[model samples]
Target: MSTPRYALYYAPAADSPLWHFGCATLGYDAFTGEDIAFAAPAGCNADRWPQLTAEPRRYGFHATLKAPFELAHGRSEGQLRAFAHQIAAGLSAVPLAGLAIAALGRFIALTPAGPSPALQTLAFDIVQAFEPFRAPLGAADLARRLASPLTPAQRAYLEAYGYPYVGDDFRFHMTLTGSLPQDDVAGTTAALGQAYAAAVPAAPAVIDRLALFRQDSREGRFRLLDSFMLGR
Candidate 1:
């Protein structure tokens, strides 16, 4: 892989019950080393973990509100850090209505149970407010993301953002599993719903902090980089 570009990500608390339970409940793999290799859970292999089949092991449970961006022209790390500090400083604390496990396309995802105005605005702010820092996407990068089937609009987004999912195309989701097979779609959806119903609490989840995460490009595993308490 080329030198990995820096990105801003909204990560979950590393040791929170949210992280532990969410990570374990889903079949996402843990980091083995600084490389991409990962192992399936000993008791539950791929065949049993059908939902995990379609997703690559690199990206696991963390929900990415704004996909990582390369720094804009001449922008230095100090400037970026300053931007982070300022963004964190001014951002209003985002209150959350508890998100639920909903099927996002083919995967199991975490989505807002109620209209989360704060969360939605926060996501939009993270993307737009940082536009001053976003580096332009290149032809080679565009060519690569274009490998996947997409509408002309999605292609436009990939050419603009490092990722294709954004704007009207964006649906805030935290992927829990990979795409499901046709035969298992209904059953798997029901199974996942049952699992979440049995597992997730029926209480409201208050948003107090914004988490930052990083991945050593070659390594598939991601680690908590930093976290800022939402002062809003």
Candidate 2:
């Protein structure tokens, strides 16, 4: 069997309205590993919403902190969990003005309304602190990553960190859909934006916890293992 893969991610508190909204939009709850009813936003049809969300549903609702990785040869899940706790303990929550639905390239996601220096530092620190636990990308994975066009800096990051989006290339976003047809982007974004504003509280969004998600196999959906409260 393929070794399980784990990811460090930022997710809203499971009991919060934002969490329910995100999970319902994607039609899957990673916390429970169960499919849920689709909460299609105003402009999207039910049939199309599922197809649009197919990709993110597999990984669950989250902003990537550290992308998925297999454990290093000498590392174990217990050790990773302990290390994650230590990292979270030292980090305070990051606050954002709010999130806005935006189209990133060809995909839809919720992005911060304003940049947060503290958030950037937290993400970078997680990437660095968790490096010891990540196995180097396999030959096939490395080749696949190289197949994508990358700037020199991104290429360097991929070689060093197993993911290209780090440092200046990183943007925190909770994905809402897979790549979309050019015609669909604007409408989808507008509709989801409306739904998001209605569903999510207007208060500032806080990155208060870090969640650990695990995928049992390449084809499997990632499930939440646990969450560590920041600075607790």
Q: Score every model by TM-score.
A: 0.76, 0.98
Alpha-carbon error at 15 in model 1, in Å? 3.3
Local accuracy by lDDT, each model:
0.61, 0.93
Return model 1's CA RMSD, one decimal: 4.2
Clashing pairs in 2: none
RMSD of each: 4.2, 0.8
lDDT of 1 by residue, 121-225 (tens): 777677777777778776776677788898888777676666777765667676666776566555666665665666556667655555554455634455455
Cα lDDT tens digits, model 2, 61-126, are 999999999999999999999988888999999889988899999999999999888888889899
Worst 10 residues of 1 by lDDT: 31-40
Model 2 residue 162 lDDT? 99
Number of backbone collisions per candidate, in order?
A: 2, 0
Model 1 CA lDDT for position 17: 53
